[model samples]
Target: MEIPQANLGRGINLGNALEAPQEGEWGIVIQEYFFDKIKDVGFKAVRIPIRWSAHTETHFPYTINESFFQRVDDVINQALAGNLNVIINIHHFDELTEDPLQHEDKLYQIWRQITERYSGFPDQLIFELLNEPHEALTSDLWNQFIINLLEIIREANPERSVIIGPVQWNSISGLDSLALPQDQNLIVTFHFYSPFQFTHQGAEWVEGSDSWLGTTWEGTESEMSAITNDLDKAVRWAARNEIPLFMGEFGAYYKADYESRIRWTRFLAREAEKRDISWAYWEFGAGFGIYDIENDEWDMGLLNALIPHVLVFDKDASPQSQSR
Candidate 1:
């Protein structure tokens, strides 16, 4: 079977998907009408990042509640109906958030359930192993544990594409340490917040990022070169292993200036094309605002700046790209 590919991370992280409405209070179902707008905005896929463990029976060992699975499935189907591929994964399912290894049995069972539940979903629905494992795990520890997880996933999902990232909260550079399982049905995944000086400038979540305040994303030739060089390294690694490389996440924080953010993304798109890698931006709305919800329209000025670099067609169909 041919492995599936995502056009770009021009996808939404379904954060508002699950909520038990209280006393007539309303919450979005993820499958709501908004996706037509998201899909129309040129997104090729949607990553339904579910935080299900909170609603699950902890004692069941990776056994997810049926209601949650059904809800997730409904959303997944919605994206598919909109002609978009789907990426589903365990996002923050690791309760400890620090030591996933300590819960090996639970982790294995979690993946087993996910693999079985989505076994019938076709190529378009991809599985990301985890959403950025944290807690200062050593390289050896992560490698061995991931290899085992890959073994389990492959047992049930031999042809379904799987994604794996390194232990440093899915840092791109740390990705060098990942050794994919012997199974060929997997892709190495990593997140990009490069020039953290530029991308994560004023993210309230990041401490010591005060320096990036009031600064526009200064995407220089050097920074662009470094990014592509790093991505090229990943591509080469994949080629050696005969697997695909997926830059699963990259987005500038909302603090960056409008035009600068567009410039930065254009550079990212160009660089990804140059390296023969596929990517997904951090999101379609909120924080990244690929779509400005308040206006109910794209930041056209931003999208226009990026149009020349955005990949409207598959790389193979792309015209000869001149160097940046």
Candidate 2:
């Protein structure tokens, strides 16, 4: 089972859509054109965050709704049709995070069904067992849970590449505590929103974020060093463990100053590439998006910061050649 390490390069998250309580509840319905747009703009992959828990039954078997599965299948098909690698994951299972003991079996059942359903999908399609395990789902519990989920996945899709991240919302610091099985197809992921005050400023979900509004990352010596130092931790860990790393998410929120967003986004993207760490921007069309759905245009500043003109993905080339 070879990992699609190249496919993980230069990606963006399809956030605030399927991960919401409903597909459009958070305002993005994932139109087919979105895939074309993403691919055209030089992104090699898209990490789709889905809340499978919201669509499954609570009891034994925990069957996922057939229509919901079909909808997800359609999204994957669209992405593949455009030749973009797709990474789908179980996301925002808040109940599970709050009470893993009570919801553990439910999460397994969800993945069991997902893996079996997509068992025959193309290699470009990847599975991410879970997203950002935190709260009651501590590191020890998450490590064990990952083992259980991978067993379920391997039963149906033995050679498929799967992405797994550490706990504490996939924090880089959590990497030291993570434990993984000896599986060649696994890719470890972590999220970055360092200097959280700057990145998450004015995000309504965070307490006291209002006061953090106007916070900025100016690419100053201290700020740049902070990011470099934090990312180096993940780099060192991956080198020692011999596991490929993916910065599954990183971006400044919409309310952040425009120049700061560009500076931070470009700096991080380049740094990750320099370290050979593949990354996906925090989102596509919400608070932290590179694409503007309303204007039907890209936030070119951020877009250029991420892919850059010189590094645009060559759609006509072989997959291997497309690696950054």
Candidate 3:
């Protein structure tokens, strides 16, 4: 099955913003202008990480608040209008990780409502099953959940390309444990943050991140080799399984040195593109963001490194100013 452009393009995640416990709580707001800005910066896709659990009723049927769903709908509509491939997923469902069995039914109920709501959307919209399943959610248990949830999604929208990642925080090695279903309309995904000490250095959210503040990705041969080896494993697995692979997230946190961050970012982007793997960077604006929402501008150095062909955003002018 050929991977559609909607599922196989350079993309960026609208992270922390919507995925936070509360929208805008993380300091980034979803605005209609933001979608246009993303398209203007040459991204072909956008991944919106949404926390549906927070807004939904915690009972049978798991009713998603109409207002919350409408807000997401508006965001999706904006992205579509800008001709961007959009991915929406269940993010930050901490309860599920804490007690998978306890929340299994609720998870199913949420998906039932989501799939039904987006049932009539165009193919440009993709559904990602869940984000970084970890902790109590073992691979075996997650695999079972995936099979069941996919069945529910397929029942509502059989042709929609659904993305599923391995357990253990979507680590590359974790791919070994994922048991993909026999559905061709599926894309396997995994996140890349190898040598985490460098990428996540000083990221307050990670334990002991402060201690790794000085770490840097100098792009040593050994470092490059490790990256290639990790990616090679995923490529081989995807080819063997005859499923397209997507690097759903990858980026160095802001604490890393600018030059080192660029080097790592460019390397990963190029390597993934070399192997024909689709990817979306970790975020738009916040933490691993490439854009600075407060300034309403892109980090041209980062942008240039990730998408070399696109013209750099001219900082001297308005945020919308651009020239090839």
Per-prediction TM-score: 0.83, 0.93, 0.95
Q: What digit string (tens of lDDT, one per residue) describes model 1 on residues 283-312?
A: 655666465555555555455443444322
> Candidate 1: lDDT over CA atoms?
0.67
In order, candidate lDDTs are 0.67, 0.88, 0.88
Model 1 lowest lDDT segment of ten: 19-28
lDDT (10s digit) by residue, model 3, range 51-98: 989988878878999999999999999999999999999999999999
lDDT of residue 185 for candidate 1: 66
For residue 262, model 2's alpha carbon misses the true position, in angstroms, by 0.3
Which scores better on lDDT, 1 or 3?
Answer: 3
lDDT of model number 3: 0.88
- Sort the candidates on lDDT, descending order: 3, 2, 1
Screening candidate 3 with a backbone cut-off below 3 angstroms (N, C-alpha, C), the clashing residue pairs are none
**Over 4 Å off in model 2, which ranges?**
1-7, 310-324
